[model samples]
Target chain A: DAMVIQNPRYQVTQFGKPVTLSCSQTLNHNVMYWYQQKSSQAPKLLFHYYDKDFNNEADTPDNFQSRRPNTSFCFLDIRSPGLGDAAMYLCATSRDLGLETQYFGPGTRLLVL
Target chain B: GESVGLHLPTLSVQEGDNSIINCAYSNSASDYFIWYKQESGKGPQFIIDIRSNMDKRQGQRVTVLLNKTVKHLSLQIAATQPGDSAVYFCAENEDTGFQKLVFGTGTRLLVSP
Candidate 1:
């Protein structure tokens, strides 16, 4: 099935350490997104890429960064992991920017100690 | 864009019963609506969608209803089964130059057999 794929379903990182989460898609969608979701909360958009054009949410902290190295692959990088940053990181993709449904991957759960 | 309810509300039903999940969206200008199902520790799966122009849309076993007047969206599942148990979310497709899915506070559905 053509779907979004995330790696390392669970991740453990030390405080102040850097960690990266990866997402790849077989759907070949033009837009990729990164979101942070804590327990019982909605997924919050951190940033997204539109065919290489990176758009970060205004309130997204500078510690969070994303990179789409190619059409099928995107990565979310946390420069300094903190206890508050521990959550499920989700990656999603859509065919285009407008009114299209986004397909999400099984998120990567990050735990910071 | 407030935090989708910090506390998840749950609906419990017997297997084979019909299930209805409701959501109140924030933006009146949202042109499209979608419903997603997220299992434990997994990503959101697309269920059904309804456009602002249409009042209802149906999938295999699920239906989505959109009320632009009240900014409400709902998902109805027939013959709800135990497998249907999950956190259901409603998202509005909003465009502000950039496009994104604004998710409503999700509801957890529990189906007992």
Candidate 2:
């Protein structure tokens, strides 16, 4: 099945350290999204890439950044991880034209110490 | 600020019973809504969706109701099982703008045997 895939299903980082999470999709969807979800909380959209065009949320912190090198690959970067930054990083992909169902990866759980 | 929210944070249901989860959105322009289920160590899986033009839509064992007037949405799960125990989130997509789906805080459903 064509699906979204995330690297490092579990991530551990120290405070003030930089970390990167990667996502790649075989679906070839034009829109790729990165979301941060805490325990039992909603997955908050940090940003998304629409066919190489990046859109960041207004309230998304400066510490968080995303890059999509191509249609199939995207990366989320945390400049300086904090204890509070520990959460599950989810990667999703959807078609470009209209509202389409999003496909999600297994997610990367980041533990910042 | 545009946001999607849930009415309850948790719900308890017995096995083989039905489950209902409620959500509210502040964006009237949101035309598309979706329900997602997330397991403990996995990413969210799409359950069903409803458009603003329609009041309801249903899938296997799942139904979604949209009340555009009150900006409310609900998800109903029939014949719930222990495997149905997870966090449910309602998401909305703005019809006019970027069309990104905004997720609610989520409601945890506990299925007791």
Candidate 3:
């Protein structure tokens, strides 16, 4: 079954330490997205890649960054982890940049200690 | 700023009963809407979707209804079961230059057997 996959379901990082979360897809979709979701809140879009072209949300913090090395893999890097940054990080993919259905991977829960 | 929201934060229902989850959107330009089910410690799974041109669309045991005039959306589950307990979210897609989705603060559906 073609699906999105995220590595390290739970991660623990110290304050000011850098951490990276990975996402890979067997769907071979053209678009990949990163979203941050706090407890009991909606998933907030941080950024997304449409075939290597990065699009960042206006309110996304500068500490967050993403890289898509190939079609199937994308990585999210947090330069400095803060206590407030501890949340679930979700990765999703879609066939294109249209109104297509986006498939999501099991999210990575980040715990900033 | 435009956003999506849900009326109820949580709802409890019997296993054999039906469930209804409602959402409202302030974005008038949103033409696509989707319903997602997210279990604890997992990413959201797509349930159903409806376009602005249509008022309703049905899936295996789920149905999505869109009211463009009121900018409201709803998801109905028939014969709810314990396995249907999860956080339900509604998302709207904005076609502005970049295709992105705005998610609502989800509603927790607790199906009790």
- Encode model 1's per-residue lDDT on A9-113: one tens digit a residue: 999999999999999999999999999999998899999999999998999999999989899999999999889999999999999999899999999999999
> RMSD (Cα, Å) of candidate 3?
1.9
Q: Estimate each model's TM-score.
A: 0.98, 0.93, 0.96
Candidate 2 lDDT? 0.89
Best by DockQ: 1
Q: lDDT by residue for model 3 over A51-93, one digit each (tens)? A: 9899999999999999999999999999999999999999999
| Candidate 3: residue B71 lDDT (0-100) | 92
lDDT of 2 by residue, B67-89 (tens): 98999999999999999999898
Measured on C-alpha atoms, candidate 3 has an lDDT of: 0.91
- The deviation in Å at residue B49 for candidate 3 is 0.6
| DockQ, all models | 0.79, 0.49, 0.56
Q: Candidate 1 regions off by >4 Å?
A: none
What is the alpha-carbon RMSD of candidate 2 to the true structure? Answer: 2.2
Candidate 1 DockQ vs. native? 0.79
